[model samples]
Target: MPPTEAADTIVALSSGRPPAGIGVIRCSGPQAFAAAQALAGSLPEPRLASLRHIRRPGSDMLLDEALVIAFPGPRTATGEDLVEFHCHGGRATVDAVLAALVEQPGCRIAQPGEFTRRALVNGRIDLTEAEGLADLLAAETEVQRRSAMARAGGAFRRRLDEWRERLLALSAQAEVAIDYADEEDGETAPDLRPAIAHLRQEIALLLTAPRVEPLRDGVRVVVAGPTNAGKSSLINRIVGYDKAIVTPIAGTTRDVIEIPVSIGGIPFLLVDTAGLRATGDEVEAIGIRRAKEQIEQADILVWLGSPCEKPAGAIQVASKSDLAQPAERGGLRLSSVSGEGVQELIAEVRQRAAALMPKGDELTLDRRQFRLLGDAEAALTRAASLSDALLVAEELRTARVAIDAISGRAGVEDLLDSLFGKFCLGK
Candidate 1:
């Protein structure tokens, strides 16, 4: 859809699909109350739920018995008049209620994310908060939930506002210097280097923040090494099930088998890849290539080998420890069958994963926000080197615009569709 005002009333099944105890249908727009009153006899006081018999418009047919609530706007979620119908979650009943709602003159089915889009357009939330809401809805791990919640709760907004305020102040000072350069006293421009340098330092810290994307998308940990090294056995033990097939054959496993495991509440994709070695078999060669790719992309690589074999720079694990006693190596030694030292191995993995996570209370930005921040940082860096007051002020303004884009104050028209397009219907 194009960037335009949302003037029509939209109705959608806010609650997920049928066969539950209750379903929520939300309506937002100018005619929200009228639409709800048409199907369900009369609405209770605003924000109060009233039990009523919902029916087909202009007919005696009873659709369902439901609880209806009205929220007069400028105070509701969408900042518009809204109503909700809490009805039985049976598929037919929910469908019937929606059918009756759409029959109203100004009511129509809501598009994907229309409710949240309306919320954004109506100034109920900013771009960063909206993105955080999206992340919260899709979060799969404890750390992901905490990060998303913090962003959605306006932590990032608060930090961005501080930076923008400082930049605005500096820009104003530069403009004043240019305005007074010709004064009788011959006043010179104030030194802005200190403030500019401080702001740059802040941006630099954010740029180097611990990786947050991996926390959202589960970290990949690939088990790699030569064939018959108990790689599959280790994966199965870690996942606590038979996820990958293990056999006596040298090259039985010929593909990457991935299973998600959470250690210390952090999500990880434990991948068992085909053993790495030179092979003439066409299928085995393909598997080996895929294994190499997985290793390159993995956040952590576990090199599985015998006690006598070792590889540099990988978290070495002595697999099949029951067959040969491991020497005093720096890496871990565990037997998948006997479960020796498995907990220790998991603890080590957890420590490494935690090291990669961003510290709590730190401002985290998604890809779009990070890119804009980068632009602002570059502008500020350029501004620091300029001698002319006018040029410095112009660069500061450029930097300010970039910061504004993160919170939807400017330059967000083109991004609306793609950003909200990922949300499920009815928000």
Candidate 2:
């Protein structure tokens, strides 16, 4: 049975590929059961699988023998009656099944993330959880999976809630002080000066966390050094594959070769660049320029020669330990070919990336979040700069509005669309 209040039933291929052992077609919304019936000829028991022949509409054409499971409304994903058909995996079979369902009135294709969006709209999950679900689906490493799981489990939401509560408390205190301005003992009644200062400092501290970047992404590491330092070989060893061309030719790599690899469950963009050197050739010059650009932009630089040149404000790593004697300058020495100090390098990378943002920190994950947090941070900082309580209150309100933008508390429809609309269909 479908819930009368449910939305229009939508269907999509739940499992991506076909021609496998099984294929899954998911339908959600009010008419989910009806759509399933049009294809399966009968509704399967709720949450239980039953074998049936899925046929095309107005014809005896058998799509495939499949197992059907029906979930009644308010208990399934999207809080609507959802149906699943496990058919023999094949593109033709799945498409035929979907076509039969969509041919029915009130049945339509589910848009990308429509199912998850329904869950969010129906109060089954929050925005943070929705983001986590997406992350979980896209996670490629154990660390990424764990982080996404933590986020999906509402750890991030709890942190956001705590930050919001602190701000709310401080705002309430400021409001009281503003309202009681005429009281003889107004200064002592609400005592917002200390509270506001505390809240501002706490927010400022949280804004320093580095997890903001790697929380949903990976770090970028560029292997840069003078020629013949085994840059390509090191990259191959790190990734455990012969991805980059390795040879004895000097300046062989004339362009940036970037590979997305994970170490110790930490994702990193490993870039092998043209040997950094004085070059006059146009192509080599461009590669050198790009190498420097990557070096400047990378989270860490793996310097691959003796007497490595250090980049200011970046971690320096000395590679090719097998050839060079144990001479320490200011960077860690490593030999990717010999697997020496590789474990330590991986650990250092994880630790440094983690150190970017401290735990319990709440900052923006992308440029949008950064801008919003920056606005709020700036507002609060400006407010703190002013000693006047009234001005402080106004500034606090402005900052609060900025923070609200990040949490969708201020009704940011455009932001929601931009964030959630990128998800795949049937998410």
Candidate 3:
């Protein structure tokens, strides 16, 4: 069912700018089909395209020839009567069509993500799916696309549904125990302790889902080591481009050079820093300081040095291995010149970065969403540890509310404002 006609009708250019061959002007609400019919001179069949000459409503002035399509209530993108006018992709033509839409009764400009927000508010999509739609818009890699697809496809909902069902069952069992304990015949039911324990374990497992934020956002890998260890060369090798200067001279890298690269389906911001060494030259000392700072800030620290002693901490990599094979202390050996261990280094980098990240089920591109999940998880943990059944039930209910906030099932205020605030208009 549509929202109780509380919101006004909204209209916007859905296809966006630089109108290729066509631009789509979309409208939805109680007045959607009527608005379309008023401007387009009768409705196109629902969900089917038809040619129509769009003109100013009540005026014979031709605006543009367009393919008009109508989607009636409950079958449309917003779960309302939605109509789209595919006009010529010119800025003027699109603007003229939008002008026509606003002239209709009860129509106004669509807010940022208003269309998807409608889908959310109308129960057409949950919060995660709504986030997925936005994530899809900004996805830049295959891994990102897959992560967004999972969220869009109700992975969060599936997880929550399982948790909610378990909680509900436990609550029901607890209630039955309380309700029927006084009965003379004494009704027996499943034990509450095991059920609660099982629920806690499942929740914990979900809380530990593979973290995909780096993939969803981007991963940062820093290349650092003593001078002449081929840090810049290793960077170029990993990026498959000579992005950084490589020289035989020590302290060649005196400043941090960061470049964004994609590797093994993951995005990487590769940082090539000045060699780390106890330097006498002021400039070289500064570079060493900066290198240590970059390493500390990096998502994955790649410590490159001579093929001699392995670093006590950090992921040690023996760069310039073509000269001499280094002792392996569960270390990665690589030769930027020969590409030795480059593949292994890349895999290890991604694996280590992923290990430090939160799980995929917990991977929320939206920072606010992740925080909410964390808050809810904390509440759930506290709730699960309570000995009192009623308190546990209350805490579980609170946890469910937080989960719904992420799912957008809680009808949060300013949600559209917060979401669309970040988007460009007419998107």
Q: List the residue pairs that clash in candidate 2.
A: 19-89, 19-90, 112-425, 209-357, 210-356, 210-357
For model 1, how does the per-residue alpha-carbon lDDT over 199-299 read when each residue is reduced to its tens digit?
Answer: 98798778776555667766778889889988998888888889899998888789998888777677788989999788899999999999989888777
Higher TM-score: candidate 1 or 2? 1
Best by lDDT: 1
Over 4 Å off in model 3, which ranges?
A: 1-6, 165-190, 222-258, 263-265, 271-299, 302-313, 316-347, 350-385, 411-418, 423-427
Q: What TM-score quantifies how close candidate 1 is to the native fold?
A: 0.72
lDDT of 2 by residue, 1-427 (tens): 1222245778888787777767788988888888788888897778999998988868998889999999997876788888999888788888888888888878888877778877766767667677767777877656566666765776545665676777777767676666666575635644565666666676676566445345455577788887777789878888888988888888889999989886665567888999988877889899989998988767777776445366665555677677766656556677877888777776776787666532432323544555666777787777766655677778877877877666556666665576567777667
User: Which residue pairs does candidate 3 place in steric collision?
Assistant: 127-407, 209-359, 209-360, 210-359, 210-360, 211-358, 211-359
lDDT of 3 by residue, 124-201 (tens): 777778767777787775556666777678777777667667767666766665555546375564456656656656
Q: How many residue pairs clash in each candidate?
A: 0, 6, 7
Candidate 3 lDDT for residue 367: 57
C-alpha TM-scores of all predictions? 0.72, 0.64, 0.69
Please give the distance, in angstroms, between residue 355's alpha carbon in candidate 2 and its true position after superposition.
7.6
